[model samples]
Target: METQLSAARVSIRKGKAKPFWYGHPLVFSGAIQKVDGSPEAGECVDVLDQNGNRIGWGVFNPHSDYRVRLLCLAEENAPDYAIQDLVKRRLEEAVLVRRSLGLPSDETNAYRLFNSEGDRLSGLTIDCFGDVLVVASSALWVEKYRAEIEAAMRDVIKPRVIVWRQVNAPLRQDGVSEIIQTISEETVTVRELGVNYQVALGAGQKTGFYFDQRENRALIRSLAHGRSVLDVCCYTGGFALNAARGGATNVVAVDSSAPAIENAKANAALNGIEDVEFICADAIEAMQGAEGANLVVLDPPKLARTERDLHRAIPYYRELNKAALECLGTGGLLFTCSCSAAVSVDLFLEMLRDAAHDAHRRISLLKITRAAADHPLVPAFPEGDYLKCFLVAVA
Candidate 1:
């Protein structure tokens, strides 16, 4: 007795249902063998195995390489399920998890509220900045269900303002042309672990702040005592400020963005920190003369936007890390990071190793960390494991 999950059925190619069976949410166009009841984009459709057995359900998109992003497995797949309520339910679940982690507390009022695939909601990310919420929509389903999602967020997060944003590349990939914000607010000051930063509501970079590096900055603060530190691509002086607060004798931070440099300087003033120097310069050029610093941080922006650019982005990282290694001597520390989702942990570490070898430096990896706890990893979806960090002790 075979039961169809929905009116529109998408059958997986033979031998392609394994990944979906393991809870892998993405169903690419190539993996599908047949589609019945020609579902329109952003329509809720049931996914089936080659044998015509219902396996999962997800929203469909004809224009995307990822044709369907599975929202639930067969067990949870039921009759008359309100697809719109899934967004509300999943968002509430994400919020509950964040609350359990003590997010938006006295010390830290900013963090990632929803992490897309990591939270089982593909193409939607929510970052909280005090009372302001920034919603980054990167999928057709998210754009289609924007109203329902907003209602859910309001009930769950209760933010005073919400700003909608979409990465141009992702929007194109998802076949979503554009998205707009329902509300906006002025800049807000957010505190993270005793350090104060003035975040320009929708300016700077991704969601206006690097909350994924929260734990990493705190880790840098712990190890920066009495060291001369260089923070490259120092957006808003996150690592630099933490380094100065951590008793770094001298801090030189550099970024290509003039606005970022100005914001960093302002943040320095906000914290009454005068020891850190904010420089408006390209990261690679700035690092060439960044010697004498015992502690160096190389947190560059995303270089690999797509999988096709993986090979190209690797050489870039190799050169960047080599330059960073040149600034450090024996026993010096190098805190390097990559936020490219296309770059895997093994590949990133290998690139770091290649950089060290090319620089003629023997380094001991002290620790390897990823995005803070709020950004969880979904094993099946390795792309969810973006933001890889490495702590090295040069020898």
Candidate 2:
């Protein structure tokens, strides 16, 4: 008689092998055997070595190329833990880390509570904006723990509303349905660096606003006082709004996305700020035509999707940076950034150097910035790290 488990059994194939690998137990093989001991797919299972010791546990998807995505590795016969327990423990740990950093104060209620793999929570991320929490799920396990995650958010931080964003492309590839569910209130107000932002949890870009750039925006504002500033790809006018509020004489924001331009205008209005101008145009074109601006910001979207896309994306960055350099006045500031994980910090700096050379100007590095404290990066996993900003002065 064969041992029984709830997961399906998938045939393991090796290179040019005819006989299927058998009697090999995996903690999560996505392979389930029937009462008669047959194979099936898309089930969760535990994998074990030939010695009958548990190796790892994961969800199995035979239809997709990946047979198993391990969630955990634990010894066999361990007490079965509910998904809720896992979510609660992770949330508590995240909260503890933030408190240690002295975040979540009266002035700034917006910060990242969980950053998916960064926080060791695997496929779940939660961003808190004032009284609202935006949740993005990228794996089936996270979807399974949805209710528990929401409960933890309420019990731990007591946010006014929790918005669920299940439309991530990776989740759909895993055969998971996408649905935006509002777990609590409809509106939430969050303050960041003394600026109050009104966010509608039901409808907004990834988690309502761009919390990752919170620190960078504040830094730009500090340096932009009395300067003529230009913000490229200024989503929701984060940098632009901050520049104007920081006493910049003039601030112009540009983006190709119409919706983004609209949102930037609305954000400016929300702050009762009128010194900034929003332009719905390609940033590259805007940079080429921009003149008399001493401070230029070039924050393009992720141009490189993967390692294969890097070669092509490098030229685009070089061109954009070169254009910004050409537009900047003498002794002007250039704040440029790349949010591509494939683009390393060293490579990004080299590209900027190359751009400066091509534009016939020398630049002195002012400061280097990364994602805010909320978006922590694990040393072992570089993929969790993205968002690199460079502050330079054209000479």
Candidate 2 structure quality by residue, lDDT tens digits, 34-82: 1122324434555444434444555555443344554444533332334
Reference-based TM-score of each model: 0.94, 0.82
Q: On a 0 to 100 scale, what is the lDDT of residue 326 in model 2?
A: 92
Which whole-number lDDT from 0 to 100 does residue 329 have in model 2?
62
Name the lDDT value of residue 312 in candidate 1. Answer: 90
lDDT tens readout by residue for model 1, 272-310: 999988899988788887769999999999999888998
RMSD of 2: 6.0
RMSD of each: 3.2, 6.0
Candidate-wise lDDT, in order: 0.86, 0.73
For TM-score, the strongest prediction is 1
